[model samples]
Target: MFKLIIMCLKSRSNKSGVRCYQNRPSSISRSDGRRSRFGFVGGDIGDQNMWRSRPRQIHINRFPPSSKVDLRAALPKAVQGSKGEWAVDEGPTLRWGIAPVSLMADDFAAALSVLPEQHHRIVSCVAAYQSHALAFAERHQVENVYTSFEDLAKCPNVDVVYISPLNPQHSELCHLMLNHDKHVLCEKPLCMTEEQVTKLLEKARARGLFLMEGMWPRCVPAYHYLRHQILRNRLGELQNVRCSLGLPVSQGRLGLYGGVTSDFGVYGMQLALWVFREVPRSLKVSGRVNSEHVDIAADIELCFTRGKRAFIEVSAERKLSNQAIIQGKNGTIKMNNYWCPTRLITEEVDFEFPLPGGDQVPPTHYHNRLGMCYEAEEVRNCILKGSNESDDFSHNESLLLANLMDTIHAELGVGEIADRKQIPDLQRQIEKVQDIVEDPEELASETCRVVQDVSSGTLETKQQEEEAPPRSKAIDAP
Candidate 1:
């Protein structure tokens, strides 16, 4: 299933480097998220396994190692506010090259234009569609357009690779690029499973390539503003912090997703990971996962330093909620859904703290900076200055968030399922059924007749069908 094909460059060849391409077993079917029923070559299907309806299979790329390097030595340590757990360094322009990533072309185009000094520009992009990549490259004046990731690594002029592949595709793509000696900037929830993340991080460290999870929230400039305001100590000792962000889940678009956590919980987990001023000094979190999968919608409470607390609630079940409230011993600041507070309300000794303006008005100096715009600036600044990861979201914290989410799912009575029983059919004696993925044609097929095999009068069931192999749960004090 896996192999390493080594490539070599000739001493006098005009080509700068060797490119590796491993055609996947099957091409990803590009349609409205539909599964492809590729010509199922009838092989020796196990007598038992063949009876089961097949789930969609994902195509994957295999890579060969042409070269290797020790990655830990190349990292740099720079910014400091929360403390120095990560050593991010500062240096000069890194001729940046991106691969396997693209988002709203206009946003990325403008950001690249705003960047002051990046040595070289080369990128290989993948989107849901090729036209999307073409439009972005044409609009942004980027010369290269690569449809596949392997071709991107082969580009002679790349330094750093950006990975924004579809969620499941991330871990492997990241390793492929890092192996090619390029720094990486990858989008959040980089990989769904914890094992994938740990391996990616370990590989990045081993290769000495800069790798960061692109959790844009951490890069927003408002963080600087928020940090200064809090450290200014104007609000007195911070007592409790609460933040919530919710949007109408378009069931039409998101409902069929089947994975509930993908929508609502991903937002809260990402925000709660970064927004709070301090992580739990001692944290205990628990929540529930739907029977469907780890598609969870849950609440978490974090007890922080000095009796303070942080509460985070998320659910795919609702449509609208956008409020961040930071309450102090004396006053409270209510932030609009995803933005900094349009108004700050302070209190004193169980009474409202006096305002500079009228009762409904805030001080004359509140600013509303475009958030996403600022995130791009942060990425540019970090790359140009040679900082490896976003301080707001260090490489380590991203993994921690995934682990916490998993822990929360387990601690709660999430995996609970009731017993199943056979339903005797009026026409045929009996049948048993559990939830419900049916195709109209398949419903009429002989496959439906197999339901009688489980007609045992006594009900028997198993909990937690199976999960990927476990990861090392090495928890350090938060």
Candidate 2:
């Protein structure tokens, strides 16, 4: 009789704090130290006595259940095959990795809930904390849990990594993943600056690796239908887009990225850009900022080519309609919950694109999060087709949105809270350098060089100070 040996690799805590065992098969060794291919020991192939004398360390469970049996139960029916399945020859499966399981965790989970298991799998996860990684792993049935982003990037099994860390960390993480030759799908805003966005895009292109901003709105079925209609001039002489998105998030939650602009405003900006398909001619921006230099609200007016324009309002301190209206000479297209839209309305028709229903819905903080699966599907398709970016949310579009955010932030004078925190340190360093370098011309040159190097992350002011010659002074005589 063939015997199966089960080994408990580890017991990890799930999201609910329940400990679960991760079991796998282990090979058994014979008394003479020879390995047994079939996990059996002893000299005879079918000796019952030899099988009984097998190493006690090996727990033989003759009818051991498969580890993946309960995996489907943890996911919704959408991923469990309630929806249509992919064909057997669809393509190679894409193994996915996710990092820093904090913000957008629900959205990722929701997307995975709807993605077909055969085509994609959440194989690895990385979190800043080991406990968080373990919990996410147990909850998602992910096979690997890494506490470092670098480890996730280095994982050979992970073909793609979805980065959803804080806004400021997006660029650095993207560079790390891209350098490792792993495809990246980052959540918006892709970066705090247009320059950063440009560098990331260039790196991705040069490396021939896929990179995309997880702008799920662009992948929504309703948005696709709306874009097709506008392109066909069904709306007639596109005039303007008016969009507003707001939620009463606390000041503490805004963190260093500041207020609604980077957090919520990018949605409206991208929507207008998607509609116009061109950069704006000029911008008129107005907003409210708190004492902490965080932008609490913003209202922007974008002037596009041919006298077309878009107006957007976003708020982090208060709640607003969160709806969008696109008006043209002939008719109007209105979207409900425009950011992650499921419904669109026009004069003659009301269109609804509902989420794929299942007995269990994945836990998510945002509304209509299951709709994110569309974007996930798009990423898979793009990767399979050997494309680096999605046509719906191309790199150029992301750059445009980043530039618009940079302009809006500059206009409001509420730069990223993280950047603002470094202002005093930079100013102090400049003053110190000025004291050390007496000549104005030399001072100016040195300051410019150091600042430029610092901005590029190639040098540090402290190191420069240490390397500078000691200040010379004439000794006073009495």
Candidate 3:
């Protein structure tokens, strides 16, 4: 299995509209053919303008326009798209290796199970086998299973390492596999921080080790068709793109605000930043207060350097709803279960796009693994060609996500940083990062009358449920 690991739009000062695209010049640049020779830097489609793709810098104003445009400072040296001529190689008759690294194993394991059915491509299963592992082996007629990373990593003959550790562990494990001269398909957020991400990019370049983030959204032919339609302008001028998926804190942890925004909101937030192809400039969060006056739910609003904008609402207090809605000036596209639910709705320019492109799925049938199978395939393909890193989910991309998350925490509220043991390890880092929490009274007074400090002089639990949604991680992508 490939492993990897945000707020809905909280509105503040609803009266004053935010200019989502401000300082950055240019919107989407036109490119039919005759693209730039150096697609590496200012040449590719994602380049051109900040509004059209992810912002290159953490702080937009800190650097000049030139510095901002060439965001490839830390990308892998061996730059190559999952380009053709390198179409995914046919699987080896006898499967080479298998490694499961994420909490959810259904997708990766399922992909492995099919190897025997189709081509006998996968041979061994390693890294903490779960209940499904045995059934998969039996069904696929394979016989090897490992319950430890040690055994998997130590397999000298193992051709590929299937990695799916949590967000924090992805970087080191990926590096370990690559260093072992084994190909690797680790999950998304492949590196937790920009520093670690940078390291992976360099290592991949040096070793020609295959690496790709687990983002299944790209793998589906349906999405490719969607992009094609959008590119053709058959969809018309896209006005707003909004997608959200959230769950209550898996461990019921408390975050800066009572609603626990830290753990799960990153996906939504990252999506907000990514789809717009811009960095979040000013982030806003608005929540209602209970008797204790703690923030329960927030409608988080992120204004990008470009005008493209997104809002997410996340709350533990509500039933689960994961949806994606994209509205164009002339049409709309909506999905029911973004995390692999089968139902979706697409209405455009007096026509509702059918299931071939969009539809709906009942919740009862939603049993797929955390949809990341494509990322794993990408890794295998890259390794087969002796290439390292991938066009999608480059090391820089993961690092940017981490840095962006860290930045968002700093802007919205101070995230109390603690390791798994809840021991503070980076007081200095925290201090350097998150905004200095002023007196609670200051925020209470500043936001809304509905919010107030407690009589006991402590922030309360549970804020108003705003629209801001949490980031969905692998589970969020559909």
Candidate 4:
């Protein structure tokens, strides 16, 4: 049964803001004497429309519309109601509060639309601008709209917050929501640095709140099938994983803090980690950076135990095969659009899992993005079970991925976008080197000398310098 209980705030003469509290619903026991995880008993799991025949209920408590209210004091504790508090019977619907209307936020809403109404609902939203908040509220049918994170954090009815801002804003916003005792599911690349991700994990653990990186692939059915195959020894001893993802784009990705490795390569790296389930023994990376010192293309090799390895190539300059192949001693498994896979091929069988919302265009920016619903369902399940982290994409996995990204960025000499002062210094150094090798013959000789030193692991010999051609001729020679 679905029920809605909304507690609206009414201004009182002396109190700064209105405060309300409602008791949480107890789990309902089935005829077999087992309690349903989500407090409701329903038909078979495969019947998607079974909930439509059952009753539906929604409970939303609106935050005060005043700036003078002390949010910390107005908010309720994470635990259930205390003595003497009014109790309201409600369903197990988890209230969601989204922030900063963006493409990802819309995608999340679309995903929620497909889920059972008794399990999840969007009750509140926070936007940077009033107009955006109004528009998002109108479009999503959300009644409570706030413009600041502080206000969103003060909302007592919001059970969890789905943060989908820019890449850099992820850490700060996640901290805010967790501090407010709200569960969080932030987008991938949870933080800009490994240390930041560590801190967030620590905070989530200390607060006893659920936290997960929105690496949607981990929650999809195809990935589950692949994991099953590995666990059952269907692929034998895994040896190699080769994946490539790339796109031909210029402006948005080539700017500061915009790198193809972080934006596109993370999917491949996560997949490799999922297969190997351990840290690589040693790794090597080579990538080309644009004039802004941001990586545009990269070739990464991760060497693991027993000579197993993973090769990944990611680029923003052009398109690649966009496929992942896992080679084992017994057979190979290939995945198309491995990042958000819908098709899987093994020697024994070919599996296809099409995305939800058939024939309806998804409200997402990327391909096969409707798969995001799987992750949303994962979050709902975890929160309902009172878990602090998901086994599919755990804290340790996120930490490993963050550390890997840090290593790749450091090797590529890509600095944080916030560090603007280093750009001029780097440009000046380049100019100084150019000034020293102004003559074409001198430049060509220096290049040849460096190449010889690198190739032979020794100083340049006279024969190497003698073989060097002029810069113009060398350019045409290649």
Candidate 5:
């Protein structure tokens, strides 16, 4: 029932790099004839109809952190103290250094804003996009904006680095951070291959430093509740798991290394693997691969040896309900936005509705949505306890995820970029910026000389300090 139309120019690539043609959508129409603040249209009638027709349901149960179960028991034993309790309180307040500011970085900042002041502090911001980073720094009041990633990596006050750059640069940047002995909490899809994950994780382990993929859902209370139910067999024998997450972006292309599977399919895979706690015996996949050789839409089926199956669907070309359902012999668990689940519903029926006794978890404002802090807390606890990786979302899981995705790409013929290094050249660009910063006086004269050589063309400058509009677009996850 939810509908969105995205207009995109045909994508083209050569030896140079991926080139995306941009053209705004000429019209956005909702069936109910309503428009949002961003001029996107939507309708409540279609939403209500879709919900009423759904087989399962979801409910939000609100509970304070104090009422929640002890997370220590769910975490790895290495993060436990002498009494087998989490040593969360023993650690110093986490000082975060956010690099390569973008939309996701802003999301992290929003999540950090709600955390307890004593638990965390954002000490610095490092930006490669000069214009955008300068604007972000002024808005967030971040005083230290370093041009060099090395500077942020070496800053003694920066205990951890939150890497939120584009996908291609994740591996290189993470390697850089780990080489400097800085704990890292990187954005999802940590790297392109399991080999990369293994290498970086090995480095973290060697240094006795903490490193974790920012899988926030795994750390949220809602997911914890679901995990308890599955582990306890509250849903009876597991039968099937289904997940869907779809959205429209510029011409339906996520980026160079981004498509439906890389950008959105990871959520479905993580959910399935976490629930089953086992790898599938076989996998079957079919999808639409775009001109750029990235999956535009994917439907994957993973068959387990125990007569169980998991079906996952993801896309960057349309809008879906964006929910997940786990089916079992006795009942089903339905999760809305399973990637960042805020609601959970247990229904004890195959065809009949109206269950008698079922659990419904209420949502917490910060914990449910902007809950990156939950992962941060886990990282802090692990660091204080001297653990190298989180048990909840361990390196093994990351490797599994990467390997699974790699298989999907192979089957779909989602060929790797011919010149992958040319795409998302953040490292190269940042090096140039760093060089300019390291020798500002010489670069200034050089810049003036270049300007003088350009035929004395007058440059227009706006003196008024107008606030840059907030970037509302959602970037594909790394």
Candidate 6:
């Protein structure tokens, strides 16, 4: 049986804004699949129409939306150079530069910090506020280190930059790099607003430069495997998506970062968008706010057409399951540590009442930049091909995600950390897209239509089931 709960806020007089809270639902027993006594009373289950699982089964041969593009096919094969090391056919070998000493930057460099000539060459390093860049460069034996942004930007040989600076500085640095004809792979939550993202995209396009958000999750091997399986349609029509992610944060940073929404919410949002490849028609969000008036926890409900929906929860105070569950008519796919999926569990057989354990499996781990290398490889390919946007993480996808964050920030009453009025064009552009954002029901319907269109065979199966006589039992016991 399918169940849904929508929670929203009502204005309660307070300086911060209205805070919404609902009593937690009682835990339902797994073995019996019985509704708990603490929650709302159960309704009639005798009616087959209300309880029967949808009969749509996506054919395995057809490609689902997840696997529509090949992320690695754009690059040509490596060839022998005068140095006898592998090199691309294009002109001189690509040179890389690292910037701004930060944990994210450190992680990137660590992957490339191996023995010289081991893989790609990152020849330049620069850090603004931290002295560790020199140490990092020395340890890695990098030849040049620039203290000023100007020197790094002006360097003629530096082909690309892996930018993971403070969130607020992303716009300024991205513009600087693009203007200098340098390709960029900026970290996720690229900028605070869609206006900034659009401007950066246009700038990169005009300059003929490669630019991509470092959403490492999209490039990993496990997700690649998941997408491949999804494309084969083993699960049937995706009816629901559930994502939960959380991380413990210092109290001071919690309010400034706007808690889980800005931090882990994007992962949830990204997963949902990837599944449907459409904007949600409508969304309802309610969450707790810290004393600083920033959201620390949020429960988000996204409605898509054809009665499809997603429930996503994000929190900053404690660790979460950090998993994403994609449920279809026939089976379910569970991704552990979904943000960086090292493991994936798929249950392809008929989904029984007490979901069978045999169908579920444990996650298998892989070692590839902890999976960050996949995104790095994508950046390298984009740079080599002279492409402005990635096939996997497209410019439109970035804009949609930015706009979605804007909506969340405004709704949650944690406006931009930096004022938008400083950039009048951005403010105006953001205002323009607000009206076009789909209502929840509209988004749902649009997604459902896409699902139906792609899974035509599944629709036929549903039709066949409708013509057949009803089954005697609601759910058969194992």
TM-score of each: 0.55, 0.68, 0.57, 0.67, 0.66, 0.64
**lDDT of each structure?**
0.42, 0.63, 0.42, 0.64, 0.60, 0.55
The window of 10 residues in a row where model 1 has the poorest summed lDDT is: 469-478
- Estimate, for each residue in 45-121, the C-alpha lDDT of model 6 and write its tens digit: 11111011212221111111112222122211111112333222333445777766555555566444321233356
Q: Candidate 3 overall Cα lDDT vs. reference?
A: 0.42
Q: Considering TM-score, which of the candidate structures 1 and 5 is the better prediction for this target?
A: 5
Query: Candidate 1 on 147-257: residue-level lDDT in tens?
Result: 777777777677776665455566788888887877777755666554566678777767766677766544443333333334334456777666554443433333343
Of models 1 and 4, which has the larger TM-score? 4
How many backbone collisions does model 3 have?
49
* Cα-based lDDT at residue 167, candidate 1: 56
Q: Against the correct fold, how does model 2 do in TM-score?
A: 0.68
Instruction: Write out the backbone clash pairs for model 2.
Output: none
Q: Give each model's clash number.
A: 13, 0, 49, 8, 6, 9
Q: Which of 2 and 6 is ahead in TM-score? A: 2
- The residue ranges of model 3 lying beyond 4 angstroms of the native Cα positions read 1-103, 114-120, 127-142, 249-263, 269-275, 278-282, 285-299, 341-344, 348-366, 370-373, 412-478
What are the RMSD figures for all models against the true structure? Answer: 25.1, 29.3, 19.4, 26.1, 24.4, 19.1
Distance (Å) between predicted and true CA of 462, model 4?
A: 53
Best of the candidates, TM-score: 2
Better of 4 and 6 by lDDT: 4
Q: How displaced is residue 69 in candidate 5, in Å?
A: 22
lDDT of 3 by residue, 189-289 (tens): 56544446557766866787666666544443223333333433444665566655445432323322223343335546644443443444445665443
Candidate 4: which stretches are off by over 4 Å? 1-91, 360-363, 416-478
